[model samples]
Target chain A: MIQAVLTAEARTPGAARLHAALMELKYEFIRLMRTRAYSLSVLGFPLMFYLLFGIGQRSSAAAQYVIAGYSCFGLGSACLFGIGLGIAFERAQGWLELKWASPMPRLVYLAAKMAASATFALIVMGLLIGLGVTAGRAHVSLAQAAELAGILLVGSIPFTALGLLVALIAPPKAAAGIINLVYIPVSFASGFWMPMRMLPHWLQAAAPALPTYHLGRLALGVFGLASGKHALEHWLVLASCSVLMFAAAWITFVRSEAKSP
Target chain B: MSATAPAIPAAAPPAPLARLREVTKRYGQLAALDRFSLTLRRGEVTALLGPNGAGKTTAVRLLLGLTRPDAGAAEVLGRDPRSSAARTAIGAMLQVANAPDTLSVREQIELFRSYYPRPLATAELLNRTGLAALERQRFGTLSGGQKQRVLFALAICGDPEVVFLDEPTVGLDIQTRRQVWSEVRALAAAGKAVLLTTHYLEEADALAHRIVLIERGRVVRAGTPHEIKHSIAARRIRCRTRLTAAVLRELPTVTGVEADRDGVVIFAHEPEQVLREMLPLDETIGDLEVSAASLEDAFLALTHTS
Candidate 1:
């Protein structure tokens, strides 16, 4: 009886690989949808912040600025906590070991995770835009909204890389706390909560060094809400930071894999 | 007890599915596997039997390519274990693992099924593991034994040529253990090669076609269960006697003795000689019985001797 059931052969190797990747992606998406706390933290917090601060401001200019700033904040958390904390917990629970033993491609596993994070980033951006137009009454054209959304999505790369680096190095129990420490301070110093000029003089001076600051500047630039001397400089800083963070993450991952049983 | 080697299988053996040649894996000063060698043959179940920390896991890890052996060669399906092609043809259930808590049994099965070129149908998997009724139950909600069955289901879902089950039934109840044992037997009966690691002497006795007894990173003995049992010269003699267990142990031919409500059970190379001395000394002796030594007794003798 068992032999009869074991006789079914697989499809072509190429098709099987493709099917496996798609299955992984689909399950990851399902996990995100089912995890309410993750959804609320990634999507709810940004929406709440936008509603509170963006709508509280009567001026259309302040409302538009709030939209861009909170969008970066929302997406940044979505990537950093979503991937970084998620992987850390998975590693601690031995899920990574099981996955490694499987025939799934390494790239496919990472792609699924990153794709899930990006999907959340897009959802958060959409909610913020909807709130900005209706409740906040901000003046923004379709082109502006589309451009800002593109910038936010691209801007998520550096943060995701940073998250991965932290997750690879931190113990699972401490991952969430460590991310919080990094997230809160980086967001505040990067001027995600307000304009750089409004922050303390020293923090404003230090803003350009932070990757979130560059992301914020680019996001604000799309809406004509930020005044930076060179837009290309912010892009350059972000690209360089992305490379550095990814390299760090790769090094940490390799070292840990070698050390673990 | 006969010390003679058991007869080798009369039929020609199938080609090897996996092999480890003089594999030496080390962790600092401790050698996890020291010049160890093993072969997993097609259509046979090999049990790697040992106590905890005896390097069963290290050997499994080396063969799975989870870790490289410090020296020696390891191969699966005639290819390096690390190769994707080699891995695609193998399935494993590690000692420690868990599926996503949010997913149901059916969902997790479907997810793992997609990883292999050839995978069992979801319905077939559920039916085989006796999880069809619990297919919709969340993984987090299942009992320990049920969870283990789920892992077992995933291990064979890929129709792997060689399946590695490392302590698959550990911590399960007797009924669950028997259920798992039957499934393992089914795997072998289906012509799949299986390498199972277990400390349960009964488990190895029941499921393994051949047992490899390892100690301190070396294969101390390897043979069929009957052969291994026959290799031990000890015979067991049980009798209700007035003599204390300590006095029974004092007998020259007695290697070991245990006293309980029923009687003093004596283990000896020459039980007849021990009995010759015992019947005269204990006039209260009754219910005397003699039997061949079991695999547990054999394991104790083998591990203690070398």
Candidate 2:
């Protein structure tokens, strides 16, 4: 009986509907790819950071640390940039209302958005990893590289959720300001540009509460470059954040739909 | 088969396409719709007519299940508008101006088409809307009228049983507006029910089988165009006499008088009676004329709020 209900629901979405939803998602990604802001967020900063800290003739140990840290930073950048900024622009232009009026299922629309966001995050991570393997000349084993990729993927989840939360809370006109406020502080506090140990005690204490901090720490651990006892704790924090963000976004979606005229 | 045989095997009687029973929508201190009741029959064209803020758009939103009424019931195609089945049966075009800039006209059409179970042929719709030449052009690059045409295409692309067009041609030129009118008329001819709200009184006069005129959240008048016109007093009379605006305003039959660039428009109930009165004041008046009451006059007369 459970299977029958699920199938009945699933069967309602015909091939055309799925194709349409995916096409909308593809259109969204392609449009973002053309915008200067998305370009800067994904490629500009990561490349500059990689060159400034990960690639130069600075201290070898410092460079390796920068490499791992910036890789995680790249993942976070993709999430906040792709999901956060994209939704704000859509809301500002009344596109979300149009979508709501259409026959497109809410799940389908959100699933497409999440898929596109993940794809962009993966691309940014790949570029950073390529730089690490080729120019950084890091001694990461094949297992370590696989583990790092897996960790980066997991790290993307919480940031994406956070981006969705921002999309719900902020109006489109104020989206850029709100996102800047969110991304800057979160990025700095996570110690992406510096090591957590170097920060003050209070900041270090607060680092575990942030998704980006946990993700960065997880990336460093996977590269076999750090010695930290709280890996499990950080992992738990990221998992909990992902769940919360998803829940908040779901509530926002339902509320917005109920509002009319 | 006999000529009277039912086209599709008749089962149970299908419900009324849309029904609103004393529906009222209030926002804060403002009432957008007050006890507005309307029933749209299946496969019929019902035109919603009024000035801005007359609650026409509000009523459309209520029928689309976008807005909940403060009181009374609203249903579409036998289900509450918020229900899945009702949404599936209805399509709408609102007055929002922006679409995503990167999507080409073809892409936009194709995308909307995917959202419905049954869709019209894209090529045919494009040709009908005169957008075939600009198929590959991005939506944002098109002129305002072209964009509106694309929206019209999207609204009907679903081939929904009931379609709502709210001020679909707000800024289109004469030619484009007529083109949209034809498309709407064609939809009605094809057995699709349409609920249209438009500012162009002539558009309603030309297309709507039944008209509902709203004012300040209430249906002040509802009937056919002829009925509405007949409800108001007959022929309008005006003369470009030296009658001062204040003096003209005193006449009981003169409902309104306003200055235009060329001359003043004196709205009066009896053209012959008012014309006879004006002749003594301006015997040399070259602009004296009597004309039949138009839909615009009827609208002004019925919907004039203090």
Among these predictions, the greatest DockQ belongs to 1
Which residue window of length 10 is worst by lDDT in model 2 chain B?
B8-17
Cα lDDT of model 2 by residue, B84-187, tens digit:
77877888888765887777898888778767776777898789889999999988799999989998888888888888998888889998998888888888
lDDT of 1 by residue, B1-306 (tens): 366877678786877999899999887788888999999988899999887777898888877877888899999988888898888888889865556678889988988888887688889999988999999998889988899898899889989989999889977899888888888988888888999998788889988889999989999899999898877766899889998888888887788776656777788889989989988998988999999999998898788842
Model 2: which docking level applies? acceptable
- TM-scores for every candidate against the unseen true structure: 0.89, 0.85
User: What's the CA error at residue A132 for candidate 1, in Å?
Assistant: 0.7
- Of all true interface contacts, what fraction is found in model 2? 0.41
lDDT string for model 1 (A1-261, tens) is 433333335556666666777778778878877777788788888888887778878887888888888888888888877788878877777677777777777788877777788788878877877888887778888898889878876787787788788888898889888888888888988888988888999999988888889899888887787895678899899999999999989988877655554
Docking class of 1: medium
| Native-referenced DockQ of model 1 | 0.52
Q: Runs in model 1 with CA error above 4 Å?
A: A1-12, B1-10, B238-265, B281-289
**Top-TM-score candidate index:** 1
Candidate 2, after superposition: displacement of residue B291 in Å? 1.2
Clashing pairs in 2: none
- Interface RMSD after interface superposition, each candidate: 2.1, 4.1
